[model samples]
Target: MRKNERLKGKTVVITGASGGLGEQTAYRCAASGANLVLLSRNVKKLEEMAESIREKYGVSSLALKLDISRHEDIPAVFRAIFEKAGHIDVLVNNAGYGIFAEAKDVTPADVEGMFAVNVVGLIVCTKEVIPSMRKRKSGHIINISSQAGKLATPKSSVYSATKHAVLGYTNSLRMELAGDGVFVTAVNPGPMATNFFDLADPSGNYVKNLGRHILSTEKVAEKVVDAMLTNRREINLPGWMNAGSILYAIFPRLVERLGKKAFFKK
Candidate 1:
């Protein structure tokens, strides 16, 4: 089938679709003729976004108020989606948050909150979708990780740990689902021009320092949608940032020595 034809009439469920990367990905998928199941904690915003997408792209969309961090809430939300949309051809685990603080400074709540949304939440969502995908023998699971997952920085230790867990899980899931015809992809993007940094780095230093190197949300979203349609296993944006991952893997100590100053600098 043709690339554009691949997503036409397909059902795509995206968590965190109220704004940022999730919102952008929803637009991209809608343009490709995919029916969108948009999930977010903010019901009003999600409904507004869904209406806009439906109007602009002429694709059907459903907005569900969801808190992915609340594992107990996922099953019912997904059940409603399945009842409304029938089946999901693509699942984007895009709802996650970060708390950037020194490992010692991060509170217990901080650790729990981050893991709840980033690691455990993603796993639960994946589990919810896997059985149906397995029975059908075709599906795509796109996980939005981060460059931090590949290379742990100073203040982003906990956030990086969560993403690393996501990367590890995605890799293992990919192999397990390979024979079952389910494609799993991990997207490791560098910083993007999004509000994520407002929460991740409230002091604004990280964004101020890295603003010039950041990718736009639209650019990253396009790449993500392309990966979905083309079945790419992994996507690392702004090649240079991805290079850092490679360097870290091959020369951890050397890379750390060179990066420590900048990574920890205020």
Candidate 2:
């Protein structure tokens, strides 16, 4: 890899670093020579993952037990990263949860909890990091959104809303920081086989069929790292996802109609 292409010697902070895309991205970033600050609510898993990265890539890493749902935890974690690394070159806001339920079936608490991690928490983390980035006039902020960010799917009403908020936030923030040299990007992925399904509504078939077309967690991580290096603004993995976006944009009512049809058939 070219010097600019390599993540070597950079300090990156990744939330939701315990499993799935976060875990895979941590390992890949370490291999590319980026020192990592991995944060997740699962302390034991985070420690184990940190050890694996160190052993394989010989890169130093720190694991912080974090619950992105709790906004109060942001300041302290940001302080630790700043103190330890002097500056955070990249911030990957990947720690988010999803709740799969029809709008009527969704409770207020369920919606609130998802937003706490998926939208508000991401915003809070970015807010905490921006002062440093603005001072230096350089940094990368990568948010892990979803295909649902671009289109709504049945039973994903609340989840879709949160991701859509992320999409809007990323765009607006990117523009505001454009001249400041702070790059803000959003990574929107389609179906992926992860424990995300385990957290979704149990009766929902959304995960069953969708998970069948899932991409590998490692592939998603690689794409994320590539996006960071290239300074991409918005990325939809696997190409077909862009097609999905186009389809949704061109045929808004089509999805709702087809969704209801599919529901009846089921």
Candidate 3:
């Protein structure tokens, strides 16, 4: 099947569709002819985004305000979505946040909040979609994890833990759903030029230090959309970064010693 025609008339639900990777992916999916169901905490922004996507791609779209971390709100919100869209063909768990700090510097609330959005919220969203997808025996769940998941750094301990949890969940879910025709993929990209940095690093040191290595949202979005349509197992951007993950798994001590400066920069 042609890539563009693959998602024709399919319903794709994306969390955190208000901005950054989610927003870019939404556009890519719409261009490929998917009916978009966007969720975020910002209803007005989502509504506006949905309208823009509809206008640009001529695809049907629905935007709803949802805070996945809330947990209690998920069922009702998804219920409304199902009532409106009938069935979901793809689910993009793109809503997540990070807080960069040393382990000791991270407050209890910081840890809880990060886990709430990055791990628990993702699980809940996945739980909500599984029944429907399993019944149909077909669906795609794409998680926006990070390279940090594979290799932990000093200042990003808490955030790395969350991504690590995401990757673990994605791997396990992939196997469990193998016979069910439900695809689960985790995307582990290196830093991207997004508003994420503003939240993750207010001091601006991280982005500045990363310099020219940061990936672009458009590039990452294209790869991610392709993965969703093609049922790829995982997509890791900037092959070298992923290679580091492999090396770390094999020679943790050596990699840590050699890459400590880059990985644990202040």
Candidates 2 and 3 compared by lDDT, better number = 3
Each model's total of backbone clashes? 0, 0, 0
- Candidate 1 matches the true fold with a TM-score of 0.97
TM-score per prediction, in order, is 0.97, 0.92, 0.97
Clashing pairs in 2: none
The whole-model C-alpha lDDT of candidate 1 against the native structure comes to 0.90
Residue 229, model 2: Cα distance from true site in angstroms: 3.5
lDDT values for all models: 0.90, 0.84, 0.91
1-266 per-residue lDDT for model 2 (tens digits) = 21234578888899999999998888878878999999999989999988988898788899998899889989998998899889998999999878776689999999889999999999999999899998998899999999888977667888989999999999999999888888998999886777887787455565565555667787788788877745688878767766767776999688557556543321
Worst 10 residues of 2 by lDDT: 257-266
lDDT of 1 by residue, 155-215 (tens): 8889999999999999999999999989999999988888998898888888888758879
- Candidate 3's TM-score: 0.97
